[model samples]
Target: MYERKPVQSWLTDMDGVLVHEGQPVPGAPEFINKLRSSGKPFLILTNNSIYTPRDLQARLTRMGFEVPEHALWTAALATAQFLADQRPGGTAYVIGEAGLTTALHAVGYVLTDFAPDYVVLGETRTYSFEAITKAVRLINDGARFICTNPDVTGPSVEGALPAAGSVAAMISKATGVEPYFVGKPNPMMMRSALNTINAHSESTAMIGDRMDTDVLCGLEAGLETILVLTGISTRTEAERYPYRPSRIVGSVADLMDEI
Candidate 1:
C-alpha cells in the first residue's frame, strides 16, 4: 500500500485520466477546474506524440475542456527538447505524424529523407513498410535512434491502436539498435514536465490512470503519485502491481475531496 502526501504542483496524463475514446471522463473537467481555481498549477502530459500542443488544445476544447495551450506537453515535445540538448543542428529522419516533425523543426532540426544524423520515431497513422525500412537503414548507417515513447498502445475511438513503441521495437529488432525513449517513466520526460511548472520533485504530484507508465514514471521521478481508475488500470489490476500509487480514486471527481 502507498501513502498520500501533500503536493504543490501536478503533472497529469490526458487520455486515460481526463478523456477516453474522444470523450471526457466523468468529473475530469470539474477536477481540472478546481485545480485551476485553487491556483494549483498543472500540466496535461501525454505519451501520444501525434499532435502538437495547439492541436491538443483544440481537441480538448472540442471535448469541452477549458485548456490553455501552455498547459499541454506531449512526448513529441519532450523528444525534441531532449534531442536539441543532445545534438543541435542535426538532420533527422523522422517516422511520425506532423506534430513530431513540427516539434523537431521548431527545435532547429532539419527533417530529411536519407542519410540523416538521427532517426526519430513516434506515432503515425500513415506508417508504412518503406518508412520502417528507411529508418532501419539509417540506424544501420550510424544514425542515432530516438523514440518518442515506449507505450505499445493507446486508447482510441476505435479501441487500442499500435503506439510508437511497438514500431520502434520492430525497427530496433531489425537493426539491432536500441532507442533513447523520451516519454513517461523516463527521467527526461519528467524533467521536462517539472521545468514547465518551475517546480521540484517534492512539490509535484503525478495524477494518471496507468500504473506501468504514469505511476512508475512518477515514482521514478520522486513525485507523489495519484492513481485514478477512470482509465486503463482497474482496482484489481492496480492491486496486483508491486508499485502502488500514493493515493487511488475512482475518478477525477473524487479529487475534490482531497485537494
Candidate 2:
C-alpha cells in the first residue's frame, strides 16, 4: 500500500473525480471547500475539449460547484497555447466546436477553409461528411495534424459518444498520418497546468478516476495520483490493471477524509 503524504497543491480531473453527468459526487463541494480552507491550491485539469474555462466555470457553478474560471484547464486551452507558441497567426482547419475555435482564435490562430497550415481535430456532435473530406484533403496536402486528446469516447447520461480520438483516428486512417495528441496520458497538458499554477510536480497531487488516462498521466508526469471510484473506473477494474495510483478512495468524500 502506498502511504499518503502531505500535498500542497492538487490537479483534479473534472468529469469523473469531481462530478458525474452534471451532478456533483456526494460531498464533492465540501471536499473542495476543505482544500481551499486548508490553503491548498488546485486546478481542474480535464481532457474534455468541448468547453472554454468560462463556460466550464458556469456549468460547474450551476451544478453547485464553486469553481472559478481561473481554476479550470482544458485540453483545448493547452492545444491553443501550444499552437500559439509553435505557429502563431497560422491558418487552421478546425474540426471542432465553438469552444475549440474560440481558444485557437484567442491565441492568435486564424481560421480558414483553404490551404490551412494545421489541421486540428476534436469532437463535433454534428460532424458532416463534407467537413471530414475537407480535413482529409488538407492533411493530404501536408498540413500538420493535431488532436486534442486520444479518448475514443466520453461518458454521458445516454451512454458514450465519439470523442476527439475517434475522429482523429478516422482522419489519420484517411491521410496516413498520426496526430500529435495534446491531452491526458500525454505530458504536455500536465506541464501546462503546472506552469499555469507555478506549482512543482512533487508538491502536486492528481485526483482522478480513470487509471488509464488520469492516473497514468499523473504518474508519467511524476505527480502523485489519487484514484476515486465515482466515475468510469471501479476498484475491481483497477485491481486488474497494471498501472496503480498512489492512493485509492471510495469517492471524493473519502478523499477529503484522507487529505
RMSD of 1: 1.8
lDDT of 2 by residue, 183-245 (tens): 998988998999998888887899898998999999988899889998988999998988789
Off by over 4 Å in 2: 1-5, 257-259
What candidate 1 gets wrong by more than 4 Å, as runs, is 1-5
- Candidate 1 per-residue lDDT over residues 1-259, each given as its tens digit: 6454577888899988899878999888888788888887789999888899999999988888988898999999999988888889889999999789999999999999768889999998888999899999889999999999998986767777888889988998999999989998897798898997897888798899999999999999999888998888998899999989988988778777656
Against the reference, the lDDT scores of all candidates come to: 0.88, 0.87
Name the weakest run of 10 consecutive residues (lDDT summed) in model 1.
1-10
Top model by lDDT, which number? 1
